[model samples]
Every structure is written in C-alpha cells, then in structure tokens.
Target chain A: MNPNRQKVLDATLQLLAQSGLSGAGLNDVIALSGASRGSLYHFFPDGKQQWVAEALQIYAEAFAEGCENAISKAPTVSQGIANVFLFAAKMMKARDFRSGCPVGAVVLDLDCDSEPMRVLCLSIMAQWQHRLAAHLTPLPEAKALALAKMIIACFEGAFMLARLERSTAPLTLAAEQMATLLEAQLATVSRSH
Target chain B: MNPNRQKVLDATLQLLAQSGLSGAGLNDVIALSGASRGSLYHFFPDGKQQWVAEALQIYAEAFAEGCENAISKAPTVSQGIANVFLFAAKMMKARDFRSGCPVGAVVLDLDCDSEPMRVLCLSIMAQWQHRLAAHLTPLPEAKALALAKMIIACFEGAFMLARLERSTAPLTLAAEQMATLLEAQLATVSRSH
Candidate 1:
C-alpha cells in the first residue's frame, strides 16, 4: 500500500472505532490522515465505501490473527480466552475507551448502505467464531461452536459496557466469568473421558 | 400525548432500532409517522435531540420493565435470566432481525452530539444493573452487582450477534450458558452456606 493510502485507511479506522460509519466522512479522513482530497480520491475513487471496507478488513484480520496466536500459545483454552480479553482491555485503556471493535460498531448500525460491507461484517463474525472453536480441541465440534458463540458475544458486550462506563470492570468480570465457563466445560470433558 | 406526537416518537425509535441515530432523520420520522413537519416541530420543539432522548427513554424503560417482570415471575435466577433472553429472541424475530436495542445502537456511535443523551445512556445502564442486583437476594451485594453486570453484557452482546447473523442461535447459546453459570454460582453459594 502507498503510504498515503495506508494513512487514509488507518485514519478512517480510527474514526470508525471512535464514531462509527457515519462519522468517518471523507473530510474527516483527509483531515486525520493529513492526506489531500486529490490523494484520497486517487486511492479510493469509489469514496467512503471502499475506504471503510478496506480498513475494516485490515482490522478484522489482524484481530483474528491476534486471537489465534493467543489461543495457540496458551496452555489452556480458558487462559487463551482470558488473554484475549486482557488484550482488549489494554487496547481500550490505551485508546482512553474512545475506541471499540470497528466491526462491532458497524454491526450495531443497520444503515451501512452497502450490501458487501454487511456481508463482510457477517463473515468477520463467522470467522471469529470458527477460529475460536478450532482452538477448543477435544470438545465436540457442536459444543465448541456453541461455546465460541457465547465467548464472542460476551466479549463484544463487555467491550460495549467498558466503553459506556469508562471503566474496565465489565471486561474484568466478563473475563472471570468466561474463565469459569471454560473451566467447567473442561472439567466436564475430563470427567467424561 | 397527542396522537401525532406519539406517532413521531414511535417512528424515531423504529428508525433508531433499525438504522441507528443518523438514520433517524427528521424527514424519515415525518414520513414514517405521517406527521407533518409543523406537527413534528410542535411535538418536539427542540428537534432531533429531544425526539431521540424521549424515544430512547421510552424504549429503555419498557425493556427494563419487561426484564423485571420476567425475573420476578420466574422460579430461579437462572430461569429468569433465560426468560429475558427468550424475550429478546422473540423481539428480534418479531422485528425480522432488523431491530436492535436503540441504546446499543446509539452507544456504538460516538457522535451522538449531546452530552445529556450520553449521560442518559449511562444512567439507564446503571438502573438496569441496580434493578437486577436488587432481585438477587441472599447473594452478597458485590457479587450480585458483578453478576448483574455480566448478565447485561452477555445479553447486549448476544443481541448484537443475533441481529447481525439474522439468527437467534447466539441468544439461545447465551441463555443456556448463562443458566449454567448461574447454577454453578448457586451451587457454590449453597455449599458455602
């Protein structure tokens, strides 16, 4: 990616995290990226749709990779899930809680105006669910898939609460509860085995 | 309230749930409500801000009340929580999955453009936590509060997933998992006692 184009997408993503799709106007992108209108138009001739789509794809992929790495490296699924929440908390504090998952922000809104973007959001969620379930080895596939759904749902909800309250308490509690849930599942599996 | 005023507020809320804050434009409200521009202004002299605030208050309060009713009528905390999730699932299906919590929709966007509205959202969440905690008798207050927070977080997150996936599977999973967690907590409490 050209430096200017990368800068533009990064800025758009920041805006999307902080203010959502409607807030990532072209002018806001140009201003934040310090890129000229001519440059932005040159890179994203299709305008806001392309900018948002590309930026969200970058963000979602990186997020998925981070979760995968965390899960793959951990000794247990519970710890891996806890580490993911920890990373999310650190990111929130670093951004002063002004940011959230850009994909989540987009999903909360029904007016993303582009069918492809909506599909992208749905695909991102499905990918997250699949990747997380893959790490929960030994669990039946259906159980793993269901657990993965609960984990992601709790995570997204905790992130929203943390942002709204400007405190990471919800994230902390969610992390603990998720750990408990995962441990229970593990215990049940071990007992059965 | 006059029929026209009520119509306008209802329309605004529908738009808020479907498309979020930006999508609930005055023109959209007028068109949906069949209220004239003059009547809209007459009902909401302060315009969109007042309209959104009042509409959200109605929606949030009603939602809270419905949860309270479910909780109060259930045989156990786990069942009560499950009922709340069931109600949420039903609402999503009724709305054809196009609607979500209006408050969640607004919170996802940082550009709500009104400090009071932000404060109102914060208060609404606090009220939910407080009300849910109050229902949790026999548990230590701190534990109750923490559990309440986790429950609300899961509910919001599951609702978002259900909307995006256009399926209630996430909500179903969350409800089941929450019942498990709550049952575990109860077991611990009984053992400690």
Candidate 2:
C-alpha cells in the first residue's frame, strides 16, 4: 500500500472507532493523517464514502485474522474466546474507552438511504462471524455458528457498556460468562461423542 | 405534556435511534414532527442538546418500566430476561430493523469533546442496569447486578447484529444464551441453599 493511502485509511478507521461515520469527515482525515488534499483526492477519488468503506474493510479483515490467531492457539474454545475478550478489554482500557469496534460504529449510525454501504457493512460482519466459527471445528457447524453469533453480540455489547462507564468491568464479566457457557457446551459435546 | 411538545420529543428519539446525534438536525426534527420551528423552540428553548437529552431520558424511563414489568411477571430470572430480549426483537423487526437502542446509538456516536453529553448517556445506561437488577430479588444483590450487566451487553450487541443482518436470529440466539447462563446460576444458588 502507498504510505499516504495507508495513513489515510488508518486515520479514517481510528476516527470511525472514536466517533463514527459523521465524525470521520474529510477535514478530520486530512488533519489526522497529515495527507495533503491533492494526495487524498488522488488516492480516494470517490471521497468520504470510498475511504470509509475501504478503511472498514481493512479493519474487518485484520480484526478477523487476529481473532482467528487467538482462537487457534488456545487449547479449548472457551479459553480462545476469553483471550479475544481479554485482549479487547485491554485495548479499550488503554484507549481510555474512546474507541470501540468500527463495524459496530457503522451499524449504529448506518444511513437507511445507503443500500450499498449497508450491504458492505453486512458482508464485513458476516465475514467476521464466519472466520470465528471456523475455529470451533470440534463442534457441529450449526452449533459453532450460533456460538459465534453469541460471542460477537456479547463482545459488541460489552465494549459499548465498558466505554460508556469508563470501566472494563463489563467486558471482563462478559468474558467470564462466555467462557463458562463455552465450557458447558464443550463438555456436552464430549459426552455425546 | 402538550401534544406538540410530545410530537417533537418522539420524533427526536426515533431519529436518534435510526441515525445518531448528527442525523437528528433541527430541520430533520421539524420535517418529521410536523411541529412549527417556533413551537419546537418554545418547548425546548435550549436547542438540540437539550431536546436530545430530554428525549433519551424519556426513552430510558419507558424502557426501564417495560423491562421491569416483564421481569416481575416471569417465573424466573432467565424467563424474565428472555421476555425483555424477545420484546426488543419484536420492536426491531416491526421497525424494519432500522432502529435500535437509542442509548447504544449515543454511545457509539458519542463526541469525545462533550463531557456533559457523555455523562448524561452514562447515567441513562446505569439507570437501565439498575432497573433490571432491581427485579431479581430472588438472587443476591451482587449476582443480580452482574447478570443485569450481561443482559444489557448481550441485548445491545445482538440488536446491532440483527439490524445489520436484517434478521432477528442474533437477538433470539442471545436470548437463549442469556437464559442458559442465568438458569445455571440459579441452579447453583438453589444447590447452595
């Protein structure tokens, strides 16, 4: 990727996380990325929509890859999920609760008029779910998919609460509950097998 | 309340849920509510911030009251939580999945520059958790509070996913998972007693 383009995308993603779509205006991107007006237009000719879409796609891919790596390294599904949650909590606390999942930001502030943007966000979300479910190979496909949905929902919800309260207690509590639920499912799977 | 004032407040809350703070501009409010600009100013003399805050406060109170009624009528904590989730899912579907929890919208689109707005949102969120926890008298106070937090997190998370996917599956799945967790905790309490 071109350095300037990469910088612009990074700035857009951060702004989206910290503030949402409205907050990631062209001016804000230029200010944060230090990319000149001419260059920014050169890289993203379609303007704000183009850049926000590209930035979110990049974020969704990286986020899914990191979550997959976390899941693959843990011995059990529960521990793997816990690792992901704990890492998210750490990042939230470090950012002073100013940031949350960028996909979530898009979903919350989604404009009903933009069909293409909405479809792109839906695909990004589906990709995240599919990637996470792939790591739960020991479970049946349907069960794994359900659990993945639950985990995603819990993570998004907990992150929002944690951010609002300026405390990670919500995220930590969510992690423990998810771990316990996954453990119970794993035990049932073992007994049935 | 006066009918015109009530109309404006309702319109503001819906716009907030469908869009965000930025989307709920004065023109949008006037267009949606059918209220004169003069009347809007008459009712909310302090402008956008005042009306948004007022609308959200009204929503929080109604939401808490409805949730409390759901919990009080249920046979157990798990069922009560399920009722809340199911009702939310129903509303989301009825609205064509365009709207979601107003507080979640505020949290996601929260402007880092505004301290009072952030604080107001936090109090609304805290009020929700407190109201939900108040009905779980069968359990110890600490445990009930923790469960309430989890329920809130799951609801917010699931609602966002469901809206993105254009389906209620995520909300239903979250309800089931929350019910299972609460039932397991209730079982432990019974055993200890």
For candidate 1, what is the DockQ? 0.74
lDDT of 1 by residue, A24-84 (tens): 9988999999999999999999988899999999998999999998877888889989989
lDDT of 2: 0.89
Candidate 2 lDDT, tens digit per residue, A59-109? 988888888888888887789889999989999989988898887987889
Over B1-193, each residue of candidate 2 has an lDDT whose tens digit, in order, gives 9999999999999999988787788999999999989999998999998999999999989999998888888888789889889989999999998888888888899868977888998898888888888876667998888888988999999998888888999999988888998888888888888
Clashes of each: 0, 0
Full-model lDDT for every candidate = 0.89, 0.89
The RMSD (Cα, Å) of candidate 2 is: 1.2
Off by over 4 Å in 1: none
Second chain TM-score per prediction?
Answer: 0.96, 0.95
